[model samples]
Target: MSDNPAADAVLNLVKQQHDVLEKMLNNVSQAGEAQRKAAMGSLERFLSAHEAAEEAYLEQATKNLENMQGWVEKLTELDYTSSDFVTRFGEFQKELINHTQTEIQHTIPKALRDMTQAQIDLVQSAFERVSETAEPVE
Candidate 1:
């Protein structure tokens, strides 16, 4: 939606983050007891870092942080093996994916509409700064 190529590039980066998050969620969901904790930690760290990048660069795209955090908290309290956990985690994944898509499709573009070139560059710079540090170790 943004006319600026820089904004478009940032949107692409954001989409890549969503792709990574989706993979991480799948990893956590499929992880065995021996690996679930570490997998979840990596997912949580990436989620936190992704949110931080958005908050720092594009506040309008992060309106659901509190809601997402609530889901994270609820999931943390239940056993991963429980049926309820699976059900709720599925719902959480759906919501998070929806939120990310919305940001990519509408929110970030709308925010970029009002910004100058310099501001857009700043957003790109700031987002990369936070996001690069949160990349998971393979």
Candidate 2:
């Protein structure tokens, strides 16, 4: 799990979206026209919700990362060779790598394997809520 709760929630939601997409694809492959149409409709809703939620989540995460990187740049401007500066930079780098690995390898796969139905439903609800209020793109 990430230290960031928002990131964890977003990741779980993304995993759920992928699962829904896969199921919809299977329905497309094996179901009759009526069933396929129903599945496609569900897919459209899920995709709209997923995209809105992911955009909001990622926008925040990117802003946070940018702020951190700006701090790192400030540190470099101060004294890149100082022991304290080097140590802080190393810590930041390590944290960035760990965060990446955890999201890619652990959190995502674990969400798929371990999330309960209720948890999945909660994420879906969150997505729907976001989608409902999001402004339409021109």
TM-score of each: 0.88, 0.39
17-56, model 2: which lDDT tens digit per residue? 4555455445533555445444444544554555445344
After superposing candidate 1, which stretches have Cα over 4 Å from the reference?
none
**Clashes in model 2: which pairs?**
none
Predicted model with the maximum TM-score: 1
User: What CA RMSD would you report for each candidate?
Assistant: 1.9, 17.1
On lDDT, the candidate that comes out on top is 1
For model 1, residues 1-138, the per-residue Cα lDDT tens digits are 456799887787778788888998888778776787778778888888888777776777667677888898998898876778778888998998898888888888888888888988988886676568766644
